[model samples]
Target: MTERPSLKEMRAKALKNPEVKAEYDALASAFEMKRQMIALRKAAGLTQEEMAEKLGTKRSNISRLESMSASNSPSIATIENYARVLGYSLRVGFEPAAAR
Candidate 1:
């Protein structure tokens, strides 16, 4: 039997490609937002079901909103609502991008 490369190793190799890296960089902000959303929910000690109840939505809806691979992008209002339920206020800001 052959040993398989670890996911971290595979990811590092894949990210070495300029095209793949570019695509990954483009999606970084969305991934970071989803991560922060999940973190906030956990820190607030709320399960998806609890979050759904607070938001007046279904558990599945909460799951989709926190998913990185969700097909539809959530609206700003939806994000604001999510943050509000977690005792947070949504704040969007701009920063200079790294020189390409």
Candidate 2:
């Protein structure tokens, strides 16, 4: 009978896959977005439940979002929707960092 690969071996093999790398990057972005959203909500002085209700979502959804993982991520339209509900403007910009 063939033996199954160990967890360490499985991790090494997965990390070498391009698809895995891409997925990791995507998850990283999701985590960052979640952090920013939670910070904004707090700055606005709104509780997760309050924000979720204002955003037309459930409190659990807000909790998940604030916890650095909510959905794969809400769509851009969803994000705009949330911003609008929070009475804040959503701006998108791209600026490179200054040279060292």
Candidate 3:
């Protein structure tokens, strides 16, 4: 048996394909948001269950939110609540769309 390719290697290979690269670019914001949320929770020393308790939600709900798909949009109110509980604030902004 051969050793498996590393995640970085696999991702680099996947990114070479135009369609896959486009899809990844489209979902980049969602991935970054999830990363920041998880980091915030860790920095606050809170487990997902603890965070959910503070937010008055279930651990599974928190899990689902953290693992949300790019197509599944969360409400501003929901994001605001999460940020408030995490000792942060939510700020929304827009950028000019990329030229096709």
Candidate 4:
């Protein structure tokens, strides 16, 4: 059988592995959440400092929450608190739901 060479090709092969696919899926979801948080903060017309004050946190903390590469993620409870402070509620549901 033929063999594939180079790191890029090996990485591409790894993507076909179930474990690798699952890891990618999880990472994508995490990034999406960070994006959503950033969008929400913008839509509320709140500076990071303003949002931090409303959340009882520091601006840096709010900054970190919007960063996917950050080592720390804000707790779900903290996100819920921020949503509540902005008079919004967090909702999670399956996508492409069928009619009830």
Candidate 5:
């Protein structure tokens, strides 16, 4: 049997398609946000359960907040609360979009 392609290889191939690349680009910010949330939680040494307790929410809710495919986008207040629970203050800013 042949070895399967690695995820990186498969992703590179998939991203070759213009439509798939566009969709991926569209979701890049959301993906980056989720990644940063997970990193912050890890840096705070908090499990999902612990984070939920601090946030007065459920573990599942914390999981959803860190999930890339979460159906509802979290509001600024929600993000602020998450950061506050991790002993951080949230900051939001904007920069000019890069030319495509």
Candidate 6:
């Protein structure tokens, strides 16, 4: 049997490509945002279906929002709705861009 490369190893290899590294860095914050949203929903003891019902949408929609693709950005109003149902609020801010 062969051992598979670990994620850390794979990431290091991928990041060696300048274009891949740039894309990965661009997506880091988006990935973190989804993780935080999922964490908040879990912390509130809400399943996708339960949260969807509260938000008056389909469970699949909530799933899609939580697993958004690079091309599928959620609207501010939609995000606000999610936060409202989750007993949370949404805040937006900007940070300095990371050095290349």
Give the top-scoring candidate (TM-score): 1
lDDT for model 5: 0.91
Candidate 6, which segments miss by more than 4 Å at Cα? none
Compose the digit string of candidate 5's lDDT tens values, residues 1-100: 9999999999999999989998998898889888999999999999999999998999999999999888999999999999888788887778787677
Superior by TM-score: candidate 1 or candidate 2: 1
Give residue 8's lDDT in candidate 4 (0 to 100). 88
What is the per-residue lDDT of model 3 for residues 1-100, given as tens digits with 9 covering 90 to 100? 9999999999999999999989998888888988899899999999999999999999988888888554577788988999999889998889987775
Error of 4 at 59 (Å): 0.3
lDDT of 6 by residue, 1-100 (tens): 9999999999899999999989988888889889989999999999999999999999989999999474589999998888888888999999998776
lDDT-best of 1 and 4? 1
- Candidate order by decreasing TM-score: 1, 5, 3, 6, 4, 2
| Comparison by TM-score, 2 against 4, better one | 4
Q: What is the C-alpha lDDT of each candidate?
A: 0.95, 0.74, 0.88, 0.81, 0.91, 0.90
User: Whole-model lDDT, candidate 1?
Assistant: 0.95
- When superposed on Cα atoms, how far off is each prediction in RMSD? 1.1, 7.2, 1.7, 6.9, 1.3, 1.5
**In angstroms, how far off is 84's CA in candidate 5?**
1.1
Models 1 onward score TM values of 0.93, 0.54, 0.90, 0.64, 0.91, 0.89
What digit string (tens of lDDT, one per residue) describes model 4 on residues 58-96? 999888877877897767788788778777788766666
Residue 31, model 5: lDDT of 95
What is the model-wide C-alpha lDDT for candidate 4?
A: 0.81
